[model samples]
Target: MARIVDVNPALVRQRAGAASEFLQVAEERLEFIRAESGESAEAQVAASNAIAAGISAADAICGKALGRRANDGDHRGAVELLDSVKPGGSKLALRLSKLLSDKSQLQYGGYCSAAVARSLAREARKLVEAMNEFGIRS
Candidate 1:
């Protein structure tokens, strides 16, 4: 049988607030990336970081709302947990899955291009907005 645990609204609120802060930073970094000239490598890196941070923020909000930490080394487990909470195979989950899968590649490899970075940033922004709309208190 699955164990039931009490949900802590205060903790959820705190997590939501933290997620909001991370999202703000991610947005600022994305804006910086947008303002850069001619596919700057620095901007690319910033965009990648922003996307990663935005994904983390969204995950935090999902965990808080579900009253459990949605963490797993494979990341697929986190997606499963989130899907359990907000079913229907949401777009946010799909985007997060892609971002999480590409995180290491973006951070360590030289394969990230300006166009890819911009796309990731846009997806991250959408995920953040969806989380806010989900009433995570941010």
Candidate 2:
């Protein structure tokens, strides 16, 4: 089980709202981000936004359906929680995994290549959209 904390069901919309906003920022960054360029600053920014989008989307989904949000330092726990959600949760979990997998490289120091950056953005968008499809988004 993941280290998750209880969240009020009433805050579902708030979390969903944040997810949507983060997704928007990620989308915008992906568009302007010079993926093939040597400038790592833009890649880091885009990747960071993508990571944030995934985290908030996961929070919204978990809170709305399970009344719990991942609170641990390890993100894999959150992935496990999403995988436990019914129906299409497994799919969402896989996509979220891809985004989270790049967190360390993008956030810290590991060389976030263009392909990795693009992949993170793609996964992040898919997760947010899937969360919306699950009827849990605000």
Candidate 3:
């Protein structure tokens, strides 16, 4: 079972708000740094923020819909929790899972290419959008 954090409505809004802020940074910085090489630490930062935003978006969705958020070391647990929240939850889970799957490589691996960073940012954006569709309104 996914470890979970019981959340109130205020916490749900807080997570969604955080997700929006992280996404804003990721989107703005990504445009300017997209041309930079993957070795560019700025690009990596932007990508890292994107991944953070996606995670926050997932938390917001689950918190709003299920009154709980996944709190597990394995991010797939987050994905699975999201999967059960709504009809479109699985799609949101897929996006979140993709971001999580790439996290180690993008953030910790030797070099994060601009291409990979861009791809991750795109997925993060989609995940945030899905939060709105799922009624979290990030």
Candidate 4:
């Protein structure tokens, strides 16, 4: 039988909202790259890398919130734990996310593109700002 569990709706909304926003930003960047560069192999690769970085950040933030909720015995509310967290590791996550993905390849043979770097850098800035607004630091 499925048990009806009481969960904090606010928390759930916050976590989901943050994650969704992160994903949205990544997608926006990808779309822009595609529209501007068409099917150029290098452009496509760069876009992929940038999107991957955004994914990494989103994953890190969601993973941490979920972990915290689990440790606190709030399984039902785990999906909404972002609101309860004070954005502590978000900055590090943002920076690491970009570096771990496409940013590191900015100087590669077919990777050094002004547009790609700009997009990734801009996304990183947006993420940092969002994390800060949520009180995330690191």
**TM-score leader:** 3
Q: Tell how far residue 6 is off in model 4, in angstroms.
A: 18
Error of 1 at 114 (Å): 1.9
Q: Write the per-residue lDDT of candidate 2 for residues 1-138, one digit (tens) a residue.
A: 568888886676787777778778766766776558665656667778888888888888887778897884668889988888876889888988888887777767855555666778788888777776668747
Candidate 1 lDDT by residue in tens digits, 27-52: 56556554433565645565666565
Ranking by lDDT: 3, 2, 1, 4
Ranking by TM-score: 3, 2, 1, 4
lDDT to native, each model: 0.60, 0.77, 0.81, 0.44
Say which candidate scores most in lDDT.
3
Q: In angstroms, give how far residue 66 of model 3 lies from its true place.
A: 0.7
Worst 10 residues of 1 by lDDT: 1-10
lDDT of 3 by residue, 1-138 (tens): 767889898888888988889988887877777466536766777788899999988889889888898884668779989889776887888899888987888766765767777888898888778777767753
Return the lDDT, model 1, position 100: 79
TM-score of each: 0.70, 0.86, 0.89, 0.31
lDDT of 1: 0.60
How does residue 112 of candidate 2 score in lDDT?
57
